[model samples]
Target: MHDSYTEFILPFGSSPNILEEYTNASGGIRTGKLMEHLDSLAGSIAYKHMLGPGVETVGNTKEMGFYIVTAAVERLDMLGPLNPARDLRLSGQVIYTGRSSMEVVVKMETMPGEFDEKEETILLGRFSMVCRDAHTHSARKVHPLAISSPEEQMLYSKGEDMKRKRQTRAQQSLSKVPPNSAEAEALHTYYLKYGQEEELDDISSSSQLVSMGDTRVEKCMLMFPQDRNVHQKIFGGYLMRLAYELGFANGAMFCKSPVRFVALDEISFKLPVPIGSILRLTSHVLHSNASSPQLIHVGVTANVVDVKTGEEQTTNEFRFTWASIDESSQRKVVPETYKEAMLWLEGRRALEMGDEIRGLRTQK
Candidate 1:
């Protein structure tokens, strides 16, 4: 872990030009751009772990024999707000390794004021990277991580648990199987409460339900080579930024107010987007909470369009959570079809996980 440790500093406070590049229209830091930096940093850390700390550059992939690619982003949680006036440090290390994959943990923190002052972490994320043989494009074995301390051991254990949980979740995915009895019952109850036209006609009721379909926002563009990664394919970070911006827009439209980004719940890279391809992104408000500090769950799907056939193949799926700034925002999303209902349930699950993770962070 120590060998793979890496850090980079963004002098947003001291360098005006640097800050200008990252600043958004609202004067806050662009989380999407920061995500690109994180992805690059993770890749560097993985290479450092594989090629040793002394290696300055990945000289040649063909000569090096093996290269790494991001398989998935497990989760990225916002622990604190980003302060544009302060310098930020991004750091991480490889905590766990499998036969050909590694779990890299990264954190974004504000630079300390004094020498003795501790940095305040603003974000935490985990990235899954897999090593591939350059020639065969097949999985290549990576060095096993050495566990030297109890803390490191605990982190490794957590990484192992994450992998298992991912497998379990994949097996239980709605695309593969029908919802269990409990989920079915919950959907039935929701339908009875909000799906009926008579129930919707009751203006006296406190519930303000909006159709899930009504909250959709989409963007379509041609993928350019400039956004390509080392593999000559559309960069994962670029795709992430696109999806995030779309989700943010969709959330804002649904809430009718500016929303604060809470967390990037999950991102799955199903396939790579090729250069010069038609990329289409569609986002919808999957779930909404009417409680104080109302939260909205946004889901984005990225697809590559076949120009001749007019067919689209899904390449990625992203889930994000945003919080409405206005306390009075109380519109809840209601699914009208069985497919939408399943998506609603998935969004609710993601929000529940976010809540649990945030609670744990607060306790810590």
Candidate 2:
């Protein structure tokens, strides 16, 4: 119980001098920057809890060194606006543990000031982290979480449910296997209703027939020392920022107006990005809200390439939800290939789920 949970605090100054490179257009904190902080805080919580008791050094536990890498950011929900002069308080607890994985529930809230209430929870995130041997990069066992309270029990249950949902979603994402369910059928119907009648060519007279290709954006950056974590690998949050910025740009273009970030559905880290690797990010529109017409979904994927050989490997996938400034705006994304069709379907599912979550919150 002594190492079951950990907390971190990031106090903000009164002035706007701390403005970061990724601030939103209105000068508010960018969602990607918040995610970067969450990843680092979650990793710290995992490290602290894995140490059990009587571990002095942060690099080792039980006389063996290990490495922790973010496997996935299951979900990140932004409840309200975060402004300057608001300090952030982050708390993380190890709710569930597997043979080589740990699920940390991280809550981020803003303190209006020193004299204000601390109940303003702005973001809540769930991170899945995997432990590995420092030398061999092989999977390593982690200390099991100790739960002794009812609240902890409830969180443990939720962790289990999230894990199961992740597995189901991953299985559903496979392109080869056709999903045989009512939900999948409904998604297919929705796509056809919003889909274009013909494939978009290079020259289209009407601007309404916007191909998914038109919103495509590509960015490349070198993983420098500043972007690395304690393990010498590129920080998950930095990569998240890159993906988010690209997605934001693409969504803004798709909507032809400024957009507001709604949620981050998921960010999956498939492989570790070593320092000095050339990281490439590709972003494009996946779907648009058929019912609301003002919401759009963007997909951002990351790849790493060897500087010398030019060999490339996929690293991460970041999914974002954005809302157009004008509620009356209507746009359709036409899928050009089967893979693109699947991405569109997935985006629809993400938007639907986000709506459900928002609905539940409203009810509460």
Candidate 3:
């Protein structure tokens, strides 16, 4: 169904693959697994688009195979929670394309029953995937997308707009030098306090500094064949799920209560994790809203470790925002060491960027 653009629907029923028992107060289908599905579905749509219509029997060669890796998740809004009984319906399409990358928009909804006419949106996300040669492992040019209908044209334009906005926001957040803006100045003064006082080595310190050790939440899992993608690498979405869950737990621990996920800012996949690799996910509370005590930001880092050598390489970094489940849950977070201070700055940068974009969206 590749002509220039292609779309498809993937339906999945509740299974152990996507469901996990909650060890906390929050209970729902595993979101990480759902994200993995979304990534796989998007990759499928991109592959279908590459295999133009009427083109059958494409050889699985480095130059011909349409292997794609998720480069980044621009944004994912969890409009609602996933219900286990409901069948997951992922409607995805190749919305836009560049020289070697394609933009895939996937809308995840759930049908209450087999014959249910109405579906509820669980979450919707935009993924950036780059095509790569199967053997050479380099970026490969993708088939250009064609826009025929006005609706298609509108979506294509919207994709371009989002791309530009992501670029601008990224540039603003990744400045090498500290920004001279008032917000950055404020954060500068805040971080300077860390250097002024003796670093606390324990979690029981009376200072505003929250022990980095206290905020750490680590989860390790064995990557199974079930989570492998077409290329046999661990799915980016699965890594996302792991990061999300760990980040959720970190937020909860920091707030001393259950935390509700509000937004996933940006998730960047640096390298693909191979199947059978030991996946170690580490999450920590990097920053907390200074004004809104209930808002917390956590950073999740995924590392693939060599089981034999015990060496590790970073794979992906996920940033998530969560709010205290209870309105009465209020607390502030501070870094206890220079290392943790740097992490706090990173989180603050992302949080400020998100707030800036959100403000602009509200104005629009």
Please write out the lDDT profile of model 1 over residues 231-264, one tens digit for every residue: 7889998999999899989998888899999999
Q: Which candidate number has the best TM-score?
A: 1
**Per-residue alpha-carbon lDDT of candidate 3 for residues 279-329, written as tens digits (9 for 90 to 100):** 899888878775454678898889999988999999998989887876766
Estimate every model's Cα lDDT from 0 to 1: 0.89, 0.79, 0.72
For each candidate, how many residue pairs have backbone atoms clashing (under 3 Å)?
0, 0, 1
Q: Which candidate number maximizes lDDT?
A: 1
Local accuracy of candidate 2 as per-residue lDDT tens digits, 141-238: 98877787898888878888888888888887746566558656765675565454543443255455577777789998888988888777788988
lDDT of 1: 0.89
**How are the candidates ranked when ordered by lDDT, highest leading?**
1, 2, 3
Winner of 2 and 3 under lDDT: 2
Stretches of candidate 3 off by over 4 Å are 1-27, 53-63, 81-88, 110-122, 173-175, 189-209, 290-293, 307-310, 337-339, 353-364
Better of 1 and 3 by TM-score: 1
Clashing pairs in 2: none
TM-score for predicted model 3 compared with the true structure: 0.81
lDDT, residue 36, candidate 3 = 67
lDDT (0-100) at residue 283 of candidate 2? Answer: 93
TM-score of each: 0.94, 0.89, 0.81
